[model samples]
Target: MSGTAEDATDATTKRQRRGNTRQRIQDVALELFAEQGYEKTSLREIAERLDVTKAALYYHFKTKEDILVGLSQDLQRPIDELIEWAGTQPRTLDTKREILRRYSVALADVAPLFRFMQENQAAVRELSVGESFKDRMIRLIDTIKEPDAALTDQVRCTSALFTMHAGMFALRDVEGDPEEKRQAVLEVAIDLVTQAHAGAQSPGKPPKSS
Candidate 1:
């Protein structure tokens, strides 16, 4: 019984250790890719920086592209899940507003992935991550905008997301705390959603929101 218990403990420890090593590899790889440019960074360099043998690193990721794909896949998983969940819900303004709120939270950590994506557009394209990215954006917009939404209102919803994305990079130079800027951006986005929702509901009503 003691032998069995000891073996289980050792297995658990090994699993935990492996998980930590994988996360560390991801961190170091991203840092290096940012510092040295993805095209120039090699798996050997990554293994060297992590002080691990190339074969050990290869056991986790066979190539630099594999590491990048892993990073993007990790970052995009939540968004893909959110989009899938939203697809099953009834179409309503409330649902759309909630989607925006949830999406804001989902995107909080994705800022870095976006940074890598913008800098490595060609790699992302080559890897075909952009296909799912575009598809998810369409689904998200469908959740928010009315199917019969007027072009202007559609523009508002589209612009709302663009503004939120722009805020991530554009407001980097702005004064005040990052949280404050995030709230301000959220407020603006929520206002856009509210306006679009109102316009869709009110046939002859004045502007729903600006």
Candidate 2:
């Protein structure tokens, strides 16, 4: 039993070390991709920045695109989980507000990846991860907006998500606490969704005389 326990501990340590190395590679690759255009950044550069041999990097990721795809997959897990959790909840104004709050947290967690995506739009568009992310956004929008909502209300719901994205990028250089800026952005997004939900719940105004 002691020998078995030691073997398990060794395996766990190896797995952790491997995970750390993969994370380091992903971080360095994202930095390089953002500094230079994704098309121009090479695997060798990522390996060099990581202070690892090309072969060592290759053991984890065969190509630059692989590293990018890995990063996208890692960052997307929370958003995907949020969408799943939202599906299980009742559709209500409170639910929508909670969705925005949770999404803001997820976006903060992956801000660097999102910034890279914003700067490298064309390159990201060509990748599979880009398409996957777009699909996730559409699903998230559906969760917040009523199916029969007015066109304007639908726009408000859609805009709520973008507001969060734009807020992060726009406020990065501005002087303020990061969490405060995030809360301010979240407030605006929740307000937009609340307005849309209220509009859907309220009676329509009577037609005006010509």
Candidate 3:
């Protein structure tokens, strides 16, 4: 019994090591892709950067596009899960706020992927990045916007989503901490969703004074 248990532990450790190696390969590949254009990066260069043989890299990922697709999937999975979770929740102000808060957290760690996607627009479009993102945005918007909302209220909901997306790139040159800017952007997005929700709930009614 002890031998069996020891073998299982060894297998688990080996699996974890393999997973870490795969992740490292993906990270280095993305870094190289960002430094140079994706079109200019090659599998040999990636292996060189990692100090690994091409055969070793091939044992994990078969191609450069495969690495990219893996990275894209990793980035998309959280938002996909968030959209699924939001779909099952009651569409209330609190839910919208929570969605925005959760989204802000999701976007926070995705800066590298975001920068890579922006620089390699054509490559991103060719992968699952483009449509997957659009679908998630649509799901988020539908969750936040009321079925009977007026045009302006709908715009507010849409704009709130776009604001988070823009904040990542727009404030890159501004003179403030990244976290501070993220908080400011999240506050603005939450405000937009809150106002849109209130407007939809009470049509033609002016906002209550603070």
Candidate 4:
């Protein structure tokens, strides 16, 4: 029994070590993809950066696209959870605000991935992850916007989502604390959603006389 227990512990340790190595590969690959364009980066370059043999890297990931897909899967998990949670909640102003706040947090967590996506737009679009992300955004927008909202109000709700994204990239070079910038961006997004919600709640005004 003791020998069996020891073998189980050893197996667990090996799995943990493998998980760490896979994560290291993913991190190094993302950095390389960001430094040079994704197309310019090679699996050998990623292995060289990690001081690992190509075979070792291959054990975790077979190609550059596999690395990217893995990264996207990790990043998408939180957003997927958020979308699922939002679907079960009441579509009130408070719920919308909370969604933006949570999304802001999610964005901050994946800032590096976002930066890579921004710099590699064409590559991202060509990948399946890009389409998956777009569908997720549409679901999120539905949670915040009224189905019958006016065109302008709908724009406001949609803009709220983009505002958070744009803020991350726009403020990259600006001087300030990272958390502070995130809060500021969240504030703007909340304001836009609030405005759209208010407009939806109010009755339409009569046309003015000529």
Candidate 5:
């Protein structure tokens, strides 16, 4: 199992490196943009920071907008994939829960990229990257939520997903082992999923009297 996982990771790493020079340039460009202001960063500076010639960076990206598009694509492909995969899965509670778990893992893998996006909203908006990302998020939400689900249960499921993200950010401030914090956050998410599922089948049903 470990071998298979490692092989998959290696393959993913290699794939990320190959045919994704544009993506790498975008990643580095976003880093520079975030460090300095987007308005202050130049393509030449990006090249300098990356130790590459301006012409080389220009080969992959004609302009900073091009770089932003590349970065959005890199951050988006997996979520698009997840949305596609989820659309074909059974809409059972188990499937919904699995969707949350898988999403949490995917979010963790791209946390740094997410941070860059959050911090550079104006640039992301300028490049229209935010639109594509938001569209996919809506799709993901639709996948986990049933038609006509009660508002409270929907809130629980939504809160569950956000908690995982918050945990990733918040745990940094809390003093404890990282793994333990993750597990605790995961437990809360799982609990919320369970609560959401309990009411999912009956749109307006309240909890049974004890």
Candidate 6:
């Protein structure tokens, strides 16, 4: 193999190793957070759980909140990418539908984190979880909502996003397969956006002229 090819392979391997370690830290930290409360879980405890020294744990995450924030940011990256991609596309029904589709898939992987946030609302609030998630939602709404959309149509767009977010935890008590529930939620969310888009394109009430 060429020297450049070898270097590329080596870089890929190193990145994979780093990703694996980071995910391991997140997994161990989340486990500790659940077993005990996030407030009770310490950096030392996380280090002990991972069988690593505090210094090693600190290398990846400095505090419990940092670990939580890191996990949140890791989950946010794909959604951010989706928003960026959607922004470039023409604001059409097809583009909006694809956006909802991708967003649903992205949220599916964060079910555990979503539960953690729900169970530890105080801790999550302190970390500004709502602000970060809300900011992303606003960006996504902008991508779907037309400039002259009616108030009700805008509500539909916002509701569609919230439905997907809430589906992760809200549907937990409903007895059925997990993936099936997710599909059902996705269908509802898509239907919402589809209805909103159709309404926006349709001619509504004309202005009242004197």
Number of the top candidate by TM-score? 4
lDDT of 1: 0.79
User: Against the unseen true structure, what C-alpha lDDT does each candidate score?
Assistant: 0.79, 0.90, 0.87, 0.89, 0.77, 0.83
Instruction: Return the lDDT, model 2, position 156.
Output: 90
For residues 1-210, write the lDDT of model 1, one tens digit per residue: 999999999999999998898888988999888776788889889999999999999888888777887787765787778778888888776777777777777667767766666677676676656666777777677778888777778888987777777777778678989778877887788788778888888757656442
| Model 2 lDDT per residue over 169-201, tens place | 999999999999999999999988988898788
lDDT of 4 by residue, 1-210 (tens): 999999999999999999999889999989988899899999999999999999999898998888888998876898888889998999899999999999899889999999898888898888888888888889889989999887778998999999999999999999999999999999999988888888788748522222
Better of 2 and 6 by lDDT: 2
Instruction: List TM-score per model, in order.
Output: 0.85, 0.92, 0.89, 0.94, 0.77, 0.82
Error of 1 at 96 (Å): 2.4
lDDT of 6 by residue, 1-210 (tens): 699999999999989987887789999888888778789988888888889898888887777777888888856898899999997899999999899888888887777877777778777766765579778878889998887887777888999988887887799899999999999998898888887787787747532222
lDDT by residue (tens digit), candidate 5, 53-156 = 99888777798877777766755887888888888999887787777777777766776667667666776766677788877777787887777777877887
Candidate 2: clashing pairs of residues: none
lDDT leader: 2
Predictions ranked by TM-score, top down?
A: 4, 2, 3, 1, 6, 5
Please identify model 1 stretches exceeding 4 Å from their true place.
Answer: 85-90, 203-210
- Each prediction's Cα RMSD? 2.6, 2.7, 2.7, 2.6, 7.5, 4.5
Give me candidate 5's TM-score against the actual structure. 0.77
Kindly report which residue stretches of model 5 are placed more than 4 angstroms away from their true locations once superposed.
Answer: 1-24, 37-39, 207-210
